[model samples]
Target chain A: MSNKVHRRRFLSQTAAVAAVWTAAAKTPCRALAANDSWGDLTGRLVYDGAAPERERLVVDKDVDCCGKFDIRDESLMVGADGGLMNVYVYLRSKVRAIPPELQKTVEKQVLLDNRDCIFIPHCMKIWNSRQEFYIKNSDPVAQNVAFSPDLDQPANIVIPVDTDATWKFNRPQRKPVPIACNYHPWESAYIFPVDHPYVAITGEDGTFTIRGLPLGELEFQFWHERTDFLETRDWPRGRLTVAIRAGLNDLGTIKLPPVLFAKK
Target chain B: MVFFSAALVVSGCGQSESPGFRINLDGYDPAKVSQAQREAIGEAMEEFFGTPDVPRVPQELGLDAERIAVAAGPVEGRADGAQHGVYRQHCAVCHGISGDGAGALATTVDPYPRDFRLGVFKYTTTRAGAKPLRSDLRRILLRGIPSTGMPSYAQLTDRELAALVEYVVYLSIRGETERYLVQRVIDEGEYLPLGADVKEEVFDEAAVWAAESWAAPEQNPEDTVVVPPPRPEYTPPQRAASIERGKQLYASKNSQCVQCHGPKGDGDGENDLLYDDWNKPKIGVTPEETARLARLYRLPAQKLRARNFREGAFRGGGNPEDLYLRVYAGIKGTPMPAAGPQAGAGGVLTPEEIWDVVNYVLSLSGRY
Candidate 1:
């Protein structure tokens, strides 16, 4: 049989499973309510190995505006005590439930600013189910903002200096889409879209907290943007499949192994 | 002669299989694909994508899915994911099995094979800014792309053509869905060898997203021909004047025609090293890093080449209106800029000016 036929047959088989998943999610089980039992989950992701060297980007053009400050590469960033920073951790659960306190905090407009040719938060999240971007260009020169999203209209807009633009995704992206400036090739950042409230981006201390997670065998995904590519799609580096109860659960200070970043 | 040497230099360091898209189906990597994954992906494709003619899903979801069905006989595969159905035999040499425009003979072909996942079909009869009609796809399949490695399939029966078309649609949808899932894996916690518990759920979510995309108005528009405004009958002198006007317009700053398409429209323009939107935005990678990526991706440098308009190998279509639309919308996903007013404030060409340029381009290619 031709490869096309084989692929079709194969796709047909996979489509069946996909149909079931869609069919199930469409008519969601509303039984799990807000007040119906929530739990807290906290953890720290640290790299046991020495941190990678931070490369400085040379501002090729616009030296007057860009040459003001030294720019360190945000791409393979590591924090104090070998603590990994800017790592996005999200919980994958069908039941999207979070305490009211955390709900307000998570559902805020995500801001990504181009200050001195650097994206303010090198990494950010649309932690809430509702994800949007209020991108601003602080540089004197124009920053042509463009993003890679699979759905709807393409994200390409020129945000003039001191001005901002707003964009929203119809659905959560499969990965954090990279935002880039055409004018400044060196300026780039990633925005992760998440549907649930249990997602947290690790801070300088490499510590993270998802105040209210749907209790049970809470599943978590840990990802750092600069890690080596993996054979499997999920858990590019770290995965948390642990049981958490009604109270606090600290899966503390786990090592970010070198094998994950090992060159193939 | 200069262009020939340039081509040589581009592919000189490349291995025998340098322009990856050149070789036939023999080049497919049997290892990257797994049977279970293929079956799962295939099944998902069927449910979400369905045959183009009869989509298993709802109208709003998969209204315009490609349903070309070819009877290439029953193809089989080992536990590994590599399996060639109709695609590898006929199309994979030019378009990769993954449909990423990185086939074995890819580099040799000017204006690389279409990356289907971009969802931008060059040829179409539908309204401007809409997906091509099924007949458009069928026509391309049977007729074959002109002036390129793509060969005519006059020998293949219409049924075979249909199957090939259907498989291309299948690959397009499949590639798009895979990209979606990879993005999901980044956003969500799910990993490969999907957990038994969430496999169905994850597939369901992704399928829904995939179906919605396939069923989008842009992808499956049921529109009539977007005919251009009719041109006034011109006298011999008037025609001469229009062509003269067109010659100047082609070289205008806004047109930037001479920079890439060349003075004679032979595609040997001054700025030949242009990258498409996809490659242009790729940033911060060292040369070594880029090489590693290109190897994994099976793509050449993929610098955009100005079309040798003299060849009359318009990937969109050779019709006058097709040429008109090419100038109007400027072929989305390509470096070709939209010159018509529809391009908003940046648009530099008026309706009449656009037609003039169209006539001039046709004259150069001898298609006028």
Candidate 2:
């Protein structure tokens, strides 16, 4: 009995593999270029201002004041509007020179699904070297869109219920951008501009590390959407001093002082 | 007479038989015969010829005197008291004297003490987390929970450990049987006869079968309630603009949604690693419980537990609107601060901005 069952399974697996191979053979030829020469770039995108003031409400249906709300009176709200937080800075070393392997990995369309009335991933690092980003609304509710610019051109489009939309950037701008849904004002996130793959995002602990750099003094630009207050104070903006040695080198802690916000 | 005796012996030898064929009837006295000689004669007579009387016991043959001098070696004994005493001293404090887990320290814990009385042990491969396998129990006992107060007891001897395991199982079975009976009484109200005619039992079985018959259909709260149809798809240029806008809003500190919700929307915010409101180290509930609650709320487990967020229940929420309402209207009697400026509260973001924030928050859980 056991031998019979095993034989059946083996036959089924072989059939499935054959079907897959047949399907692959029928697929149209789309050549993918692989570029091994492209290197990674890593840096921090800082927001130099205290986070914006917003009402933080707790929702408890059983409470006596279930609908009652309050504003937080804290000194700071971390990673607020246009904060340039969790930006993925990468290198686009060979922009037009597409290698076969690299071209295959470049997706023609990237989908961002909106379900449960929120962005599935609060933040996304898109390598929009090829296809434009497609925003999809899977819910049956109204939604509004807001974008802050680090792109060469500013784009803002409102998305309605159960609709799909796309946003395209014609040129690269070396600045971190912000995006939000105005219908649900509390929903917000950040995007960083990069032409390379060498960038890494600062984790929840606000620490980022990038490794395997060629030995040299490389000039890197760091831009954040919340750069107004920091620039005014003459704090370091858009540039870091580093002498990359052949071996591992530790770039010590980078600190940005608290940005004060005036009461509205 | 000598010549006759020699002739008898020679004849007996020739026949391969003993030469004790004396028939002296005149001078034969029974008392004169030794005990050994009488026994041998009796045995030979029984073997060679059929005899009626035969001795079974030594006393029956007047040889009971020889049995008094043999001494029996010391009998083997076991030290069961010492093994039991060790368990009572070391284990009774937490395991209880009867291993029912109603020890003095059972109370005042977030998760109640492991009630061995029910034999429903957690952290086991057994069915329904009940009754840890013997080896499973030993592993827990040897390696106690690091953060909790349970300490490891790896010092017990192999023999002692074996004895303790048996005793624990005995106590658990006894207590669990009692608990099961009591629970049955409470649940069933009264004991019914086998195959009793009960309407409730029939109705319950029918309901179960009906529920299992097909996949559940989506619920529509009200047939009369008219929902607006979905909007038309945006043009390529319009969508491109929306993505740009979404990206811009994400980078700005004006929203600050990424602080608590997490940049990746994985819900592992910096605050998540810190101590919770109850001063307990924050390790979220088990994945199984989370999954069960998600099913109840009709949402995916990856989404935040914001849907079922009732004021009384500080941790969970029920729906997208429910979380939206919580964000708009703060929870009462809890630390979950509000995010809307209405109700004379700090309404920093306009109604439109709140909607945007709602969209962003929903997006975190794939609700957007």
Candidate 3:
């Protein structure tokens, strides 16, 4: 259509839209910004076949500190009945606009304690941008916490013995990022920064519940620490596109086969 | 009753203002063009590109520029020159207004943002010596380089990213034209005046060159990327001896790796203040220009950090062949010099020696 014709049509429609908007704006439109009523997404991502055996690590570098404890590699964690831990299940919805309501729900601080030369949480999930991390070094020896995000500049801060520092991630990560201690190469953890609040990390029991997700056809992706989300995503056990309704949406017992994962 | 009545009477209303464009002679001085030639150039540009507030080329060419304007308009302080706010927020801080890779935070960054004026992009899927594919740009926009300050704008809506990509192409073309004009003026040895015919020809040729870089790929098959030969897997004995040899080579003055990567492979080399290809200092720059460039870059001279091997986040993948390719090709646009056979006489390391160095570097991170 010509610009003149398009403008004319637009003007006429504008008046009607304005009147409708004025009427709609009388009631609170805040809820429209984000989901007011939220449902829960619950699931247990477990190993499909026989669980992979834990491999012994060669703690050749820091023998004095690292040798005190026999550390098994935490790359793959499996429990009774093939329960999996350290698996990140988060909403893959393209809606990046953080709901103001959800924004208010961010925790003041998530603790990451370094005790016995290991990051407390092997896999961590930051809900929203509002939250910051408090890294505490419980070990007597000084430890460095180095984060290498593919999207942002890498940061390595040395925390003196028994001291703590506060850090917050400015950028959101699409793929899971690894946090390694240069001094202790064996100490590795993963950080999955999601834009939305509906992200959860599996516990030792290998179960997770993502809370307060908006009602819609929400897509979720599963990621493990070693899983390269950039290359292939078959290990995510196929995508989950579900029409979210009120109350609970149980994905129930998802399986991750050992073959697809090339554990480092 | 209200909902039904509203539905019955109304369709979507009001005009969302279409996006606009303004073409500037990127990285070129206006003093070279004569008054008449300048006027003619301006008129031609006006015909080709519309005012910043209202782009006319898309309308004339039946292109849809508005539909592709950023979905979330100009978040994170990025904009395109004065008119394009989205580019400034995300890209212009590193890639300057003229796409020169010299912006407020340009020099502070390692492997500086690409100077689109040269029309060279390092990471691309379209083989060697070809303009990067739009998909390649999109991938970088979405994924972002991990080790750099470039963060992923994956959250950006599809339309927003597509619009940004188009703006980049526009800037590259503009920069290329500016370069072409400057070269022409230099060749002619003329002062303050170029004939209108020359100006027109130069502008037209530049546009064709820049435009063809994008268009020709559609018809012609992409040049196949050269794949490196397979690396030999080292046995325990070979691995130890090779690593020892690599250590000796690294310490040698000829290797030059020690100069930048340091004795411990900690990245604190003696010559830490080196420039990458993108930020390679050039002559013919006036003191005023240098000051202006510095202000634009907002940094003290920063250099690319030699990869601290112990803390391994290899930018070009971490596989065996990936490391070999890196050692062979060296990282383009960075201070890291390539040591491959194809790197010419300067490439002192033999293929086996390069492998040995790669083995040692990998062993530092325990990857080997």
Candidate 4:
């Protein structure tokens, strides 16, 4: 059979070329607008009630390797000061102006290590469709990362001891995907993959900062593993639309009520 | 009066007209997707890709409309001595009229027949995350998947095979497009009577993107196809050494093939609760939700078993090269991870190491 560029390919390629040309034509104007409007989003997710005691997960298998460390359910973590940890906050839209620093961040590899039979950083945000996700197995026991993304392909890979592997998603996910190890069922983590860099995960102190966002009206989503969506006052679907300013936009201590975490 | 009208209509026709494509209800959220919205989606799908009796393809998709005609409609010998309705005559029984994989005998099989709606094929010569080449799909039709109900249609002529292959592609694209439309409706909370704007927006990206992926192999065969290096010829001792190396790799923590495929090469592995991409969705986050989701799906979620080297019936071909590809690409949509080198990145196992693993697998099945 003769090699021929299919019609769809031809159309898409021409469209891409046109897009590049147009982008080049307007680069100066866009650069001015971007630099003038770029800002940051800083916030802390705080649990309204007292800190809930985390239940220690039972580690029955590989006691010498896995049970050496005290493993606890990282879901719904609250610090002494009522700061909630591992809350995901991200821009709702797929398309946005990506700053140079954010573009560079996509180039660097993000690590998800299996240390002491626990997935390090229980929650993470992969900020681009083609971002390199590095997976390392630091423990001695065998671990398999069941990376299942709804829109993209799912991989259940066996990452052996002291070895690391890199994975990249072809498509940005609609929602955060849960990665788990079947061997150690308790070993689980969540990853949010988006095409834009406007995402942040809360730290142990419940703090997160997403810098260099294009100033304008933008919608953001807050999600947690325990509570499906961090539904605050009047923010349905945990989505909050805000008009960003030229400087730091501080959304101080957004309190989460205990009722949101109640299980039926 | 309604019953009388139905009876009259049934009596008037010699045979009942087959039902149109049923939208995959599981794809939608009942709370969000209204009955009217579903009807709208169904109508749009029918408009883009016609009914089973008379199919149609959008010109922009660049699909082979001629082959679709040969495969659709009632099974009959045309005046030009060509065959029609080849799909219904051969495939619809298991794959269903819409290629949803819920035909008459679908539930009877242990592992359900593939639902082409997802467009995720497990076995292919293509690399990970890439659509299979035309030759890959042909290979499946020629050599039927072992240990499954899907049978080989080798008896069919080249023309018949081509028609069937194109028809399958057509059904996959149509099914995927329908899913895309449904997702958009649910995501956007669009009301009934979907306007022309929605159709155009969906067709411009969803359908066009799907068509591009299906055409990728033909357009960029070099990038899509996974070509294994030439197999090393070994003397008796050399072959033994390769198998030994493979056995170690299989058992070692580096590859950990023994974790799922047992130390004895038996299917019984440590982790028994393994599920594929198809069944994984049916499993909800909570046990209660899992029960609810399970009831909604066609079949109960089935656990996937690691292939037993002792059994030796590889679902993908039993050739050395096939085994090489399996280890290299990993079984798509399954738990088997790609052990071979990927594009611009190294995998868990090197080419030589994968070769060793293949030799060990062959030895387990007494192929060596």
Clash count, one per candidate: 53, 114, 17, 0
lDDT of candidate 2 over B123-225, digit per residue (tens)? 3322110134455456656665433445667786655555455444443433433322222222222222122222133212322222221111112212211
Per-residue lDDT tens digits of candidate 3, residues B159-217?
66887777676666655665555444432323222345543565556655566665544
lDDT of 3 by residue, A1-264 (tens): 333211111122112211110011112232333334655677787777777778877565445666787777898888878888877777777764444656776777777888887898887777546677778888765565666442232345545565676666655666577776644657878777656677788876779887666766777766675554311233223245666554566766767667656542
Tens-digit lDDT track of model 4 for A94-132:
456766766764656678999988999788878555477
* Candidate 3 ranges with C-alpha deviation above 4 Å: A1-264, B1-113, B124-136, B156-167, B183-200, B211-224, B229-255, B282-305, B311-322, B341-356
Residue A132 miss distance in model 1 (angstroms) = 2.0
How far out, in Å, is residue B277 in model 3?
A: 4.1
Point out where model 4 deviates above 4 Å. Answer: A1-39, A49-64, A67-69, A93-107, A129-131, A141-143, A146-160, A168-170, A181-185, A226-233, A262-264, B1-15, B27-29, B190-193, B196-201
lDDT of 4 at B191: 31
Per-residue lDDT for A76 in model 3?
82
lDDT of 4 at A25: 16
Q: What is the lDDT of residue B141 in candidate 2?
A: 66
Each model's iRMS: 9.4, 28.7, 20.6, 11.2
lDDT for each residue of candidate 2 in A1-264, tens digit (9 for 90 to 100)? 121111111111112111110011111122121222322233333445554554453322212222243423222335543333443333322233333444455566656665554554554555557656677766554344445342132333444455566666544434445665533433455555444334555544444554444434553333333332123232222334344443333433344554423321
Ranking by TM-score: 4, 1, 3, 2
Give the alpha carbon lDDT tens digit for every residue of B1-368 in model 4: 43553454456545575556878877334766666666677767777778887688888887888888888866666668887779988998899888988998988986888888877788898887677777788889999999999899999888888888888888888877877777766544423324566567666656776788888878997887788898899999999999999998888766767667888789776756678878877876468978877876766888799999999899998999999999998888777877776653456788898899999999999998
Best TM-score goes to which candidate?
A: 4
- Which 10-residue span in candidate 4 chain A carries the lowest summed lDDT? A17-26
